[model samples]
Target: MTARTDQAEITALVDRFFLALDTREFTPGWARAYLTDDARMDAPVGAKRGAEAVRTAETALLRFARTQHFASGVVTDAAFGTDDATASWNAYMVHVHHSPAADPLFVVGGRWEATLRRTPEGWRFSAMTVHVVWTRGEPPTAEPG
Candidate 1:
């Protein structure tokens, strides 16, 4: 594929990932669809390896009644290898909950860096690092009532 085509594909993959998360449909199948088997995700707390681990971490964040992830200003670099690429994007997100009453709990502005691979199934994230540059309000938690 041409460089332009590759970049488009990468961008789409990134968008799909965030959309899936926003919809809270992060099942194991969803993880396998978007990430490599041994993918690594480094977040504020730490890092998780493999699709299962990543799924678990994402699932925990579902404590919020609702969430949305939006990515913009995406930039992608395609390497010589057909399957290798890298991308960076800014993410604006909001987390909301309604356990007691509905309210917006947090506003997170973050950056994402990802290493991608074009697997037989299509492009998948090999590794991703998320840095929370700034956030307003405390992050929500799933504590026992």
Candidate 2:
């Protein structure tokens, strides 16, 4: 494929990754959309590798809480190699939870570092690591203080 095509594919894959999370579709089939067979993933809790392991970790996280990962300020850096290519993106994630109330309890903003490889299935994330920058809880009541 051409360099432009590869870059486009990488962008689409990253966009779909967030779409899957928003739709709460963490199934193996869906997870395969963004990850390779031996992908490595690292989060706040821990890290895991392989497709099955990544799926398991994603399932557990989705089950733990209702989350909406809003990725903004996305900037992609792509480098083309002979056969395979690598790309990285910097983004801010606004994590929201829906538990006690139908409101955002916490807004954890962070940066995501992803390493993507070109595959027959298109661009897939071979490794992903998230680094949290800051976390802030929901604002308190504004009645009388």
Candidate 3:
């Protein structure tokens, strides 16, 4: 990588990371597309590291029948250089449950901050944390399997 790499690459990486939640399923190496082998993911439910960390993270939303994650206002501190970079973004997520009962949806507004590093696969997140700023509706009552 050069002193300043292509910022667009980073932006696209951010996009794919969030979009994957919609259709991606849990599988071995599923996280290879976006996370390092030792990546850490901190969510409201909990935190973990290494492969399990990514495994739990990827499956966290499976309890919901459908989920949509939107990432906006992405800001990068070391966007183009440093081998390791920091990027943050605002996310508004809407989740729906399979139940036909009342209040089967929950909406969350949060900020996602991550540490990314260059890997042979590409730009992978070494660490990620979600800070909830606001919420509406009840979240999934069932834990992710």
Q: Which candidate is the best by TM-score?
A: 3
- State the lDDT at 81 in candidate 2: 54
* TM-score of each model, paired residue for residue: 0.89, 0.75, 0.89
lDDT of each: 0.81, 0.66, 0.81
| lDDT (Cα) of model 2 | 0.66
Residue 56, model 1: Cα distance from true site in angstroms: 2.9
Cα-based lDDT at residue 39, candidate 2? 89
Residue-wise C-alpha lDDT for candidate 2, range 121-144, written one tens digit per residue: 777888888887887765323221
Please give, for residues 71-129, the per-residue lDDT of candidate 1 as tens digits.
99999998865679999999998877646544457888999999999888888999999
Higher-ranked by lDDT: 2 or 3: 3
The TM-score measured for candidate 1 stands at: 0.89
Ranking by lDDT: 1, 3, 2
Scored against the true structure, residue 84 in model 3 reaches a CA lDDT of 83
lDDT of 1: 0.81
Clashes of 3: 0
Best candidate, lDDT-wise? 1
Pairs clashing in candidate 1? Answer: none
